[model samples]
Target: MDLNTTKSLVTSKTFWGAAVAVAASVAGLAGFTVSAADQITLVDQIDRLIAVAGAGYAIYGRVVANRKIG
Candidate 1:
């Protein structure tokens, strides 16, 4: 709801674990046919995007957690 509450969730292991699970499922589903060609490329790109998003969330959580509440 609020910024602090969201930050707490983002900083928690459960949140990241869920995120990883969702990301992996999406990526795995897309290339489940085992085309093993462009499908690998697609999965790689999807994984990279997910990793970037997770890194961004972690950075944002750190920033928000360090902010002085006024």
Candidate 2:
């Protein structure tokens, strides 16, 4: 994947927002309340984790790649 894809993983708020919304909905249905601040915190933490994992995977791919770009 290209760097833009990795950047998107870090910067795409819509995707994360939708995920959090679904999770919050599920929590609400289960009789658990998720506060706005908590949702924001969850998004921030998940974003950071995704960013780190994406970067690591990119680096690993480069290291293990057997072919060269033209």
**Best of the candidates, TM-score:** 2
**Residue 29 C-alpha lDDT in model 1:** 87
Q: lDDT (CA) for every model shown? A: 0.63, 0.85
Model 1 lDDT tens row, 1-70: 5645554454455555556566666878887433345545655665676679999988888787957658
List clash counts for every candidate, in order. 0, 0
Residue 63 in candidate 2, Cα distance off native in Å: 1.5
TM-score list, all predictions: 0.43, 0.71
The lowest-lDDT stretch of 10 consecutive residues in candidate 1 is 32-41
Stretches of candidate 2 off by over 4 Å are: 1-11, 67-70
lDDT of 1: 0.63
